[model samples]
Target: MAKDKKGTKKADSSASARMSNKDYLRELRRLHVEIVKLQEWVKNKGIKICIVFEGRDGAGKGGTIKALTERVSPRIFRVVALPAPTDREKSQMYVQRYLPHLPAAGEVVIFDRSWYNRAGVERVMGFCTQEQVVGFLKAIPLVERAIVESGVILLKYWLEVSPQEQTRRLEARIKDGRKIWKLTAMDLKSYSRWYDYSRARDDMFKATDTGHAPWLVADSNDKRRARLNIITDLLSRISYEEVPREKVKLPKRQAPGGYREPNYPLKRIAEKF
Candidate 1:
């Protein structure tokens, strides 16, 4: 495998190639089944799993997460996408707000974006001081080590998207009503500082990517392939079996027993569709 300038293996073009809708759905169905099995095993065995996703704007993190979690129980597979820090949170320890949201027993908590904000957006966007960034970079590995030692299976992912693809996605967001909200002023600012973000990401990888909790980078140029690849990689990292289950049988419903329908006039909205 040829290595990129970053010393990581260049992704095989064919491997990360886009999938047809039919093939994407077919594979997704299979993965959804496996995800359900993993969910059951985690619940049955009281396992704790935490997944953190980090990436540049328009890198498909949200889409990847949506695919990864859409088929699972929200109670079991919780997604935490916290808003900007409150004043109190800003005053408190940087990691304090995030700590409370870590996975409990029998839970698979996923952070759409996580504590590494200080290293990436916060640093590049001047939301935090260089000293604060330095401190966070230094302390995070130890914090992660503690989280691992405490029996939480932590998996971190960094979605790597090409600059051209990112531009396309962001531009689409401008013209698409559904995605316009995703393209914020901050996103525009961040887009301008592409190389700045790259530097920050490189530093983050160098500092926090550790043996206990390594950062897994995924090529996200093809949104469909990225989602499938990420979900597959996630399942691979965790050891789970299909928890045993009894065959399900639908029970017969009882007769209405002369329950007459009420004649009240209910104002129902017109079914335009």
Candidate 2:
């Protein structure tokens, strides 16, 4: 596999055949167990974690996040996919709106898309001026340094999907009823400017990929492998030990104390399945 400028391995588009669904699920189940352990350790140790996911449209960010958090507690594994900024938010500092969403002790916050929006979409889609983009790129590394120094374990991921695979996924979204909502006008607009996004991504990586919090690139052409690979990488980055647990036996229930079932009529919905 060829390495990117940052010395991270780029996803090889032609390397392998698709992973079998059974094998994928088996591996995912194992990872889920480990993720549960990570969750428990984070909670017990009061470790705050912040994970950022960024990529072009149809890059499997949502799916990967789902796989990562499916078996975890929602209270601890919080997913933040913020809507477009409101007028008041637009008036505030770009990163200010995001800081409030950072993880607290005992919480793991995952950003489906993050503050790097300015360096990616906002820059490529004409949403922000070149000057603003430059200023953001210049200042974000220092901001991230402060965030790290404040003890938040930050992980930023860039899911690199090949153009062919991205096209296939987007087309599938167009035809799949469940995924139709994933395709939007913005996605359509962004789809036409692939190289624009590529350039913007390059610049963003150069600016924000620091030693304190480096950007990890995952080849996402195969969604299953990408999800597993990212999850494995995430677990490796954190120094979490499995928290010991006490074995439990269910307490015996008391006999019903002369309580009888009520005769009142009750409403019931049909079990269609």
Candidate 3:
């Protein structure tokens, strides 16, 4: 609730730091318990959850997703990140490319950057024709409407950072060599046109924010708080009854001694790479 003179979170060490030593242990226990319950709920109810995470590069979208799904079963919680279209994909409708990533009967499909790219960055970057951008914009509400009407629960998170903060992060990435590729030519061009993108982003909210698919602005200047908020909301949103922990099943090993044969001299090992 408190901020520094910069109006940034003073107590948050980083966008990705929230729980302390004691807090972390407690938080992990709570999160694990909830995840087990949610997994069972998914299996029983056959619920479908679709979440879209959109933000400028270096906004820690991937980091947030990691934290959120840390305790979740990989089989049920899927991260869908699309690569550039293949030649065949280029010929098909854009929406078709994303269908394989949609939630199964009882799964969560989190799209890193969705089809809405046409209305936001694509439009601002001239990657698509004016017709393409306009068409996507006009169709967004209807497209989401259809998805929800078809019984898919959707959540869209907009992770936002100050322009100055974005610049700092981009520069740091370039120095780090970890994610420099994300800062593409278009991104550099988009830099000078920050105002243009801002206008376009505002336009996106105005035109496509429908009743069924509402948008939540995530203050991602602090990654920890944002991820915490994002995951907490996700946990509560999916319709599920409380799952009795005692009713859950755990996979059992078939070893006769009730433990793995110890090939691992791990406890006595002292060698380091």
Best-performing candidate as measured by lDDT: 2
lDDT of 3 at 87: 90
Judging by lDDT, tell me the better candidate of 1 and 3. 1
Clashes of each: 0, 0, 4
My TM-score estimates for the predictions, one after another, are 0.93, 0.93, 0.79
Model 1 stretches astray by more than 4 angstroms: 1-17
Better of 1 and 2 by lDDT: 2
Residues 179-226 of candidate 1: C-alpha lDDT, one tens digit per residue: 999988999999999999999999999999899999999999898988
Error of 2 at 53 (Å): 0.5
Q: Give per-residue CA lDDT, model 3, range 176-209, as digits (tens).
A: 7877877788778877887887888888888878
How many steric clashes does model 3 contain?
4
- Name the candidate, 1 or 3, with the larger TM-score value: 1
